[model samples]
Target: MASFFAALMNSLDIALLLFIIAIGLNIVFGVLHVINFAHGAIYMLGAYAGYSCMAMLGLPFWLALIVAPVPVVLLAIVIERLVLSRIYDRDVADSLLLTFALMLILNESIRMVWGTGIYVIDPPAMLQGTVTLFGNVTYPKYSMFVIVMGMLVLAGLWWMFNRTRVGHIIRAAAIDREMSQLVCINTRFVITAVFAFGAWLAAVGGVVAAPMRAIDPGMGDKIIIESFIIVVIGGLGNFTGTLLGAIILGLIHGFGSRYFPEVNLLLPFIGMALVLLFKPYGLMGSGGR
Candidate 1:
């Protein structure tokens, strides 16, 4: 029972982290109808930016956590304007190819700039220790922080989409771009904003993950596949579906790594395949954008 509980906690943590990382990809797809292949690159850049803030700029971890995503958010905005915008009217394949190219460019660019070596970041001082649960069971404080932050992010995103005017505009634009344009909704602006916001969320995940994982140029490539699975298994462009998909994948990872070590890496993909075979759209997904 205790072991099950531990696995549950670990799975939940992984689920939350995956949610934070993949939510942006869904959002961009939801609004822009463009699946961003470079989302992971932006996430990788965020971790590197956090490292830079702490290592080179002499910023504190907390400050770095807050500020590290800014540049990446801006980069997303620029990418949307300079690259994605031009292809908005083209076929979906166009955006995918462009984003794939962008991802490749970012991977090499980051390697050229930050070197091909892997880097790690230390967790904030306040999150350095462990918290005991009951009868010798303890949990890492940083892991707890990740879970809490993920909940907060979930709540914040809910409020942003449900309660805010911008959220309403986003939904409207997403539901009907041509009609939204006719109704005077700046769909162009909304698409750019959503893309940038999604980038911001991805970077935030990267910053949070810096302390937990080794930061490297290859990090994005590894995560992109997982993110794709999460998005697909949850239903492309479906917010709630993404959450459920992340949790399912997280559970698969946690238990599979422990009990089926050799197959751990393949579990999520297997789950993805099952979802595709059974539901095609995902457990919570209705369809693509």
Candidate 2:
């Protein structure tokens, strides 16, 4: 039972982090109708930036969190303007292929810049220890912090999309870009902003993940596949679906490897396949936009 509880805690943090990253992917798709295959690479860049801030520049983790995503976000903006913007009207395959190429470029660039070594970031000093819960189960403080941060982001996003003017504008534009422009909404700016925001979210996820996972170039490649699975299972462009999917996958990751070791690696893919086969629109997705 204690082990079960511990695994639950572990799954929560993992799920929330995945949710944070996957939601960004969903948001970009929801708004721009673009599949950003390079998102994980951007995430990798953010982690590297955080590492530079803390390890090399001697900045604290909090400051690194703030500073790390800047370059990634800027790069996202540049991509949107110089490359992605031009291909908006093209088929989805175009975005997929282009972003795939961009991912390759970014991965090689990271290798060139950071080398092919694994790096670890220590959790902030305040969060370095462990906390005990009921039945004497202990959990890492940093993981709890991650859970809190995820909840805050989830709340913030809900409020932004439901109660704020900017959120409304973004949604309106998503629903009808031409109509948004017809109403003087400056949809071009909104589109770019959404893409940048998605990149920002991905970068934030990278920064948060740095302390938990080993920082390496290949990390992005692994996460991109997971994020795709998450978004696909949850249904593209469905925020609620993304959250559910993250939690489900997180549970699979947390328990499958522990209890079902022989088939652990295959569980998530199996679940994804089942969802795809039975509910092509995803669990939370209704047919059509």
Candidate 3:
């Protein structure tokens, strides 16, 4: 029972980190109707930024957290204006191909700057230990921090989307760009903002994940695939669906890694295949966007 509880905690930690990243992908898709293939690269950028701040510049983790996502967010804005905007009305495949190119470019840029080395970030002093639970189970303090942060982010998103004017404007833009423009809403700005916001979320996930995983140029590649699985399992552009899918995947990662180590790498793919076969639109998805 203690081992089960420990596994559950581990799963929750992994699930929440995924939720933080995949939600951004969903938001961009929901509002802009574009599947950002470069999101993982942007996320990798964030982790590298954090590493630069803490390891290179000797900045504290909290300060690095604030500073790390700035460049990625700015780059996202540029990508939206200079590249994505031109292709917004184009077919979905166009966006995918273009963003895939962007991802390759970003990956190469990272290699050029940071070299092809794997790096690790040490957690801040406060989060550099372990905590005991259930009288016997132990978990990393940083993992707990990640879980709490994820919940807080989820609450904040709910409030923003449900109660704020900006949120309403974003939703309105997503629903009908023409009608929103008719109402004098600067939908262009909203679209840019949505894309940047999604980038921000992905970058933040990168920073948060730095301490938990090895930082490398290829990290983004792995995450992009997992994020796609998450959104697909939960249903693209569905907030509730994204959360549920993250939790489900987390569970698979936690238990599968422990009891079925040999096939662990294939578990998520299998789950995704099952969902795709039975529910083409995703577990919580409807027929169309």
In lDDT terms, which candidate is top? 3
Q: State the TM-score for model 3.
A: 0.99
Better of 1 and 3 by TM-score: 3
- Tens-place lDDT per residue, model 3, 266-287, is 9999999999999998998986
- The C-alpha stretches of model 2 lying farther than 4 A from their native spots are none
Question: How well does candidate 1 match the true structure, expressed as C-alpha RMSD?
Answer: 1.1
By lDDT: ranked, best first: 3, 2, 1
RMSD of each: 1.1, 0.8, 0.7
How high is the lDDT of residue 71 in model 2? 90
lDDT agreement of model 1 with the native: 0.90
As for candidate 2, its clashing pairs are none
Which lDDT values do the candidates have, in the order given? Answer: 0.90, 0.93, 0.95
Can you write out model 2's per-residue Cα lDDT over 120-233, one digit (the tens) per residue?
A: 999999999999998599889999999999999999999999999999999999989999989999999999999999999999999999999999989999889999999888
* Cα lDDT of model 1 by residue, 95-199, tens digit: 899999999999999999999898988898999999976666678899999999999999998999999998899999988999999989888888988998999
Better of 1 and 3 by lDDT: 3
